[model samples]
Target: MRVPTPRLSIPDEPSLALPRSFWKEFARKNWDREPRLFRGLFQAHFPTLEEMFAALVDASERCLRGEIPPMRAVRLYVEHEDGPGGIPYYSMLFPLNRNHLPVREDGNAHAYLERVTRWLGGKRFGVILNRAQCHHWGHWLQMRSFLSGFYETVGVPLAGADSAVFFGNYRYTPFGIHKDDWHIFYFVVEGKKTISLWPFEALSQREEVPKEPGFIHRAGAIHLRDKAEEERLLSQAQLLEGRAGDLMYWPDSYWHRAEPSEGLAVSASLGVAFRPPEFVGAVAPDGWPDRVRHTELPGGRDWRMPATLRTALQQRMGRKSLLALERERTTEWVRLLASGAMEGAAPVLTEAPLSPHEWLLGSPARPLVSFPLPEAQVLVSANGHSRAIPAPPAVRRRLEGLVERLNSGAPQQVEALEEAFFTRLTARAFSRRAFRELLDELVRWRAVRRCEPPASQRR
Candidate 1:
């Protein structure tokens, strides 16, 4: 029997603002073609508005505390007249230290925000936190979980995907009007925001103003300051508005800029780095040794091939003798899909190993990505990690059933699970010790987490 390549299984109850009508329209006419707004679908899925605001502040405070690990990119914006752009100014909001890193003072968010206000003489400020999918923070996890339904609806992107938070009170986007390389989905978690969009063929395009000295991000932007130019561009824009709990979709081909309604706001932007299908799929090895195998004698400047090699392309290209390479690639692709893999790699967090007694563990916010192999093994992927466990046919069925239950987001007693294992493997070679090891490894992989202590341990 041949096993087919696996695809991600969408959860029975998705966590996004997906309605049947929206999905139908998007799948039919709107997706990757034009901008459209879906109203009030994301309301029930996100945290409360107040809580969302607090999380942003806390993340900002952590950034100031230098607690942020290597981030993909964090853009802090404080709109003013000092930026290089003609009318609206947008630049990095955080003050930098001598080493050119954003600096923070020993203060809470209130104090920090107050200090910023005073320093800028009451200017508005905004910050963008790039979300890493596997981050332990509640908001980041929720956002990632919410977007999984999206990936399920639209096929997963191939090139790469990423997310970022947009928080600000600027009337106009300080960054100026520009186009992006990736299609964008914006979830309005806070106040209202509108985007003024124009077609890619808007004009011959103008050069962007040079960035302020010592400021980062001198991205290309279209000039709209000239009286005639401003009128022409404004006349052509297709304004799209989104309030709290709403979502907006726009293609990567449109030139766009933010046009906030008023006051403070925050939104989450998911970018699917969509690339043409022809460029996607597993790639071959590119190490120096592998490169030498294809190396030619260069028109008679011949030298013998290097010696220390046994089958120079072992499990690499996997086209010839390296049959295992294809299997590994399949396994890896399944695992990455299971973890909602994006451009940024997920980080493994710390978890204490499971002990030798009855314990409770359950931690899966969504469905598990798993496949049953012909070799009496079950491949399970959770939270961007995977493992294949060997068992008898009967045991494999039971194990897969157990994984499905865990995906329901409920904790089960390890003692009870062990009892089942004991019953199934009574005369088999598998042991209780091996079962415990498997559970502990799953915990370490962030696949499942430990529930709070049982009543007996509370004493």
Candidate 2:
């Protein structure tokens, strides 16, 4: 018997095709405690496996045409078994480098693709797309709907959310057994893949773990390499067999590696890191706006404690400066929370452009995760981007009600949304204008999507 495919008509958490009862059981039994597999439960979520393949192909095509940095980061890895153990090697299918690192417009991406195509047959290869959220339009929409139910049940994950696409026919994980810090949920879109797991206690001394010098998938992981050790661990390992349309979950505590059956296997791994947010990149001193006055200090600044240097430093680190930086950092954190993903730590992908008259509704997954700031302003992030909107006491009250209406997951349309909170008698017409612009931004954020989703978004 199988769990019924969850339909949107159900009252609770319809976005994921999962019942609230199932999530409760998972939270109690398997979440961070053990590995669990749900067979054939997610086919509704991924109606067509071609979407995953298309995502990979699109990334490759983008690489071939020399697109953006996110596309340039897609790598084609080939499995090599000629060595003592099966390992992975770069196929160099898309070669773009600047300062010895892959970047846009630096090398001939097509030349390498042509050279590698002949040798790609028979030999199992993997197509890994980092920041896969940007590659396909369906990824974010489905995830947003799914995550809406997830975050409500699982609570907001600290690492936020991000996505990566793993497509390949590799029999075994090239990096061997490993563990990292993240709550990973893998959606098997095609074929079959199995995972062998061992808790932290099952491993040996740290010094005994062999390390590979190449760019292994996980930089900070213990890669086990002892045949005797492998055989011993397999005897007591818990196997999670994931077939097409299956959803697999394993906590970060377990050292696990995927072993796919002999065929093409594709999975989308949505990982939420178990770590603190990095604010350094989010708010940098060099990137301060022109509003922050910059002036060259006197050469006398070389002296022990020049007053001019002190003044300049104080100006850079003053109270206003600190608040500005804090807002930036807070917005970044809120952006991830609003976007409902920080999994791959990549930029959020915006929806296709929209006209002003386009109809829209709030995202079920992330209706509105906002933080109210002083001066009648509210900061909100949805789908993936963040913005600050004006909200006075009366407007803020009405906005809360609007959000409640949006969370209903109803087939809805927008009509004079600015009037929902702002009265026509109000003298501030520009506030209404900005509020209207905020609605447009919501479309871009995917916080609120078009009334009729594209055919790809249909269940």
Alpha carbon lDDT of each predicted model: 0.56, 0.55
The sequence of per-residue lDDT tens digits that candidate 1 reaches over residues 357-381 is 5455544433455565434666766
The stretch of ten residues in a row with the least summed lDDT in candidate 2 is 292-301
Which sections of candidate 1 miss by over 4 Å?
Answer: 1-14, 50-71, 83-86, 93-115, 132-153, 204-220, 223-228, 276-316, 319-332, 341-380, 386-412, 416-446, 449-459
For TM-score, the strongest prediction is 2
User: Candidate 2: global Cα-lDDT?
Assistant: 0.55
Model 2 alpha-carbon drift over 4 Å, by segment = 1-14, 58-73, 85-122, 144-154, 206-236, 280-318, 341-359, 363-365, 369-380, 388-439, 449-459
- Give the TM-scores of the predictions, in the order they appear: 0.64, 0.66
Task: Report how far residue 42 has shifted in candidate 1, in Å.
Answer: 4.4
Clashes of each: 1, 7
lDDT of 2 by residue, 291-365 (tens): 111111001111121233234444655576386655565556445544444433223335665554455655343
In Å, residue 177's CA in model 1 sits off its true spot by 0.9
